[model samples]
Target chain A: MNPAYGPNPWQQTSWDARAACNFVFGGVGAGLIVFAVLFGAGGLALKGLVLAGLALVGLGLFCVWTEIGRPLRALHVFINPRSSWMTREALSATLLFPAGLAAAAAVPGFAWVAAGLALAFVYCQGRMLQAAKGIPAWREPLVVPLIVVTAVAEGGGVFFVAAPLGGGGTPPLDALLGAMLLLRVLLWFAYRRRLAGTVAPPARVALDAAGRLLQLAGTLAPLVLIALVASGAASGAAAAALMAIAGLAAALGGAYVKYALVTRAGFNQGFMLARLPVRGSR
Target chain B: MTRWAMVADLRRCVGCQTCTAACRHANATPPGVQWRRVLDMEFGEYPDVHRAFVPVGCQHCDDPPCMDVCPTTATKKRSDGIVTIDYDLCIGCAYCAVACPYQARYKTQKALFAYGEPIASEAKRHDDARLAVATKCTFCVDRVDAGIEKGLQPGVDPEATPACVNSCLANALTFGDRDDPHSNVFRLLAENQHFRMHEELGTGPGFYYVWDKAAG
Candidate 1:
């Protein structure tokens, strides 16, 4: 990891950095598990992804306030917690992560239990974004299902590269990934069709950006994952190297999708633009 | 059942900004930030353009989203309909600012006090330091409180009927106990069926605007 990516030196080690780390990991981690469980082969590698997701959620609770004096004050959110999903997200993540982690890190005998916990965490994460009334894009009806599908697709891409037929897990896993990827394509159509109705320009832009990235990942990444997984099954060292490269691409592509959603696609320009009238339009 | 309210007659409101000036004086609000803003609304176009002065301020809604969304119990609805903010408890998050569809809340900008004492010296002071929390019309809470202490009606005072209502040369603005049927506001409400801003949102704002037949 680059030093630039590390925690800033000026702040307290346990405060801002912890919060930022929690947000980044919790967001990325749960997202990964959701993708994995939905798309990836059910096995030891899927278990690892689930554990990492839970860890991120646990860390998110530990570091709730990124730039506030009192972290304990976050408890007040529960007062109107019925209306405020931020509070619910906090509490759900607190429980979900630990349970999911235990399940993921468990022996091969209890691996199925861990996958179940990961599944629960993903649903809660979807609901959390749904609760934020301020962001129109996040609050959309399509967002929840799309989030789940995206998570599974990304997870499958990772699992495909890692798992070999018969040796790693069940043969049905590959078919499941292919099905999930196909479902993702269906979701892509659904999201775009819905976007056509949204009058909010910024929201439209953000959805388009997210939709484009997912389309790229769905089209190219899965083929690479399958190729690498198949090659590794036939050859040995060279195939493993190819599999590693394919995994990296999937991971990078996943990051790109997230980046598009969280940063560039989050164009709240409509809010400001609403304050102005079109001057040039005749 | 303390329904503190205001009634503004748009017919008499000349858009002269007298009420705006009076509010600015009473609140001693910093430059640019007005507790009450007079919005100039233009209808039709060209030769048919007719302007109406819409005085915008905190409506003190029955179901305020600001109070609902506030993370801390900083903003509360008084027993009276006045929505008051606890400055000490406010974390300055500005969530209420956005939640308010009216855009009633204004954050104190650095430009509000760029010249420090020199600019402030020219302006009347109301203990509003440079970077204070959100400010809005209090329905003259201080006056209403003082009047109640003096054993008078809750909202009426000889010296203070809210600076805007008092200073209105056209006598367009009205303030009284909305619960009292005999009150001028209640009678006006009965007669005119005044318009409430953004009535569709179900906020049930206390402020009512009586649009005159000629004005409309």
Candidate 2:
């Protein structure tokens, strides 16, 4: 196999920005479902959040549909759930969409089911990345946990920002978002460490830069904002504004992390020819 | 009960790329798509430099990650050990392309030609179903199957063999059933020290490289 020279060589991550959107939007959507189920105070606020989550998920699926080379054959994506994580993700969405809609419509006995399916959808997304064995960075065991934690963190961040827009805020959500951020930061560190040790040098360099950006923008910045909110250092209106800004940073940072991993850091294990011809006598 | 395998003797390979040309002609692959390729590697310092030619393609592993990740069940391994793709069933999601460790798969979305001209031979064999579908070498399954139906052996009969193996000018390439004790590949394995790429990953590749210390 030829050595992968130069920065940003062509890789085997056939899934492009559309696939990244599918994972990001779907994860955030699912996270919103879980957030509403746990902390929503009912009325239009809860309904709006639920509807937004459903739309985001629908949009994400549409993005994947557009990414497929043969869109007319996309229903085949649901055919192999027994083996393919992509099929399982599609199957889970079939349950999630209707359940989410029912929850948004204030139907009884649907919120819990929607929340459960949302979590399942997030899990399926992680598994899909893990199953891509050719990409050494994604195939790491840490990827599953990293993706799950980041999804929840992004979801919490979205809720924090969007909830304030409706003139509603929850104290528990602030604490929850803080905890998710902490976990996400820790997992990001561990995942990057493992990747740094194992991936090719070129990929490691890319991952290292991505990791530093995520640490500062995705982890530390939100952490400081969350601390200010928790310390009661700001007035009520000021705190809401700070929380919303923090939420945006966290959400954008999480999306950047996913985008970098999926696009920039993703690299296939290049071909390997084990033996070298002996020196001289050519 | 057959386990098809290929062996390339490093000492005999000349890096002439005849096998690459033959494979391209046999498959009628579009430009920039090579189902079989010879990789040239240079080793040692300038004064003592030597080059080794490595022929690479799909190993058709016992545990094929591509097969496992296919959302539409489009990739499957035959009982005889050849991995095949069902292009009709493939949605061209390219999941299998990234999942393959060997980088064996290719997806050609548009028709491309060599030398900026659509060659008559390529146009004649153009397959629309192949567009956007993942494709790779099949070890010449069509020839193997046809020859088997006619009671001919694969490694011994030119008509039944893979184009790459048949086209090897220096006799570096060999194809046979690894499970057969008397097969040429089995004999080569017994006489030469052999290695498979990424064996640590536990893919159990059907392709092998035979090396002799004396050749160096």
Candidate 3:
């Protein structure tokens, strides 16, 4: 055996705590920024929210980097700068940060373009983890697309809940919520298939819990959304309250999933041998 | 127009993180960042384990996702196929952060000024200019441009060979333009069992990995 291999039988180190910190904070921050866009707000506010979200996400990813090494030299992924998703992410972030500002500063369609690109930006966060070839939970094909759905859905819900508190509303807003909820349900169902065969038992249990919460959230979203669509034309506060609850549920549920994903039981093959001793050997 | 690429012979890579450190110093990157990370993936059962040191980075694919999702056109693809970024215009929104499959982009909460100025701390002075922006690797564009001016290889900026490339102690990393049939990177791609990180996403990464069963 190669002595330089560090420790053998190699035990894979699990840094799920750090990963969860990165995932939840980034996801929530991003969802909030995107949510701000749906409500009637200027580009300046949108830009600030997006920047705030970016800060949280950057801090999270930075923590992940420190777990490895020097954070300053993080630019090495761009050496080839062609096929690397990290590079793509870096490049996209470089543009998205400013483009969001430009959109905030621009007129009409430009703001929409910035918001649309922000949606794409959130999608990449999900894809980054989904692309991980090693982790069974992360490797599922459905993971990436589902992450997009959850990000948007949760983002929308968070937006609605916070919108009124900030003194903002529109007629079609609730309709948008209904649509987002529907998409989340569909994506959840689609992701169910991959969850069965690939995921570990602990992860499965945590996901099941999260799934149940989402279903409950999903059921209430439509009612609130449709009522809000009424614009004081329907059940009034009851609908608003329902939608608020749904949004809260979705946010909490998504956070649970993120936490579960990082904290759930799994093994890294590298660090195993050191953890468990041989049958008769020391 | 230069298309950069690298091939890592897993057999020769000692997993010493020389390339990782090399990348750090080459870029003068600030802190808590890594352009190249050596992921040691260990597979198999408890007693029969196997390990692999996979050096992952930007693929520089023929179709880059970063460019597709950039809202401000800040990320521009040059004629040579290098996906680059413009820092001045960034608003630090982090939309691109969400779009990336590789988790490559980073948001700058505060600016690193000419000297030791804390831009975030000095937000009142600069109108909060430094706190809201995004930053990342440019693939050493300054070096590439200088190399071109010197009549040297386009991507072969000797002074700025990307920390990871320069740090490979076992000579695992080979960098050159893939478009040049005679270049070292092309040759590595030509005569090796090469695979890329997450090829299914189809970002078409320029970085390749050559596996060695003997090393396992």
Which run of 10 residues does model 3 chain B get worst, by summed lDDT? B121-130
Which CAPRI category fits model 2? medium
Q: Write model 3 residue lDDT over A24-63, tens digit each, in one string.
A: 6656655665666656555455555555555655666665
Best first by DockQ, ranked: 2, 1, 3
Q: Where does model 3 exceed 4 Å of error?
A: A1-187, A194-207, A217-282, B111-132, B154-163, B212-216
Error of 3 at A230 (Å): 18
lDDT of each: 0.57, 0.83, 0.57
Between the candidate structures 1 and 2, which one is better when assessed by TM-score? 2
Please state the error at residue A242 of candidate 2 in Å.
0.8
List pairs with backbone clashes in candidate 2: none
* TM-score, predicted candidate 2 vs. hidden true structure: 0.94
TM-score of chain A of each: 0.65, 0.92, 0.72
Quote the positional error of residue B61 for candidate 3 in Å.
2.8
Residue A53 of model 1 has an lDDT of: 62
- Candidate 3 or 2, higher DockQ: 2
lDDT of 2 by residue, B1-216 (tens): 789999988878899999999999999888888999887776567797667788889998988889888999999999888999999999999889878878888898877888676778877998899998899999999999999999999998999999999999999999999999999988888766678877777778899988663332
Better of 1 and 3 by lDDT: 3
Model 1: residues >4 Å from true position, as ranges?
A1-27, A33-78, A94-282, B16-25, B28-32, B108-114, B117-137, B158-161, B169-172, B212-216
How should the candidates be ordered by TM-score, best one leading? 2, 1, 3
The native-contact fractions of the candidates, in order shown, are 0.05, 0.64, 0.00
The ten-residue window of minimal lDDT in model 1 chain A covers A2-11
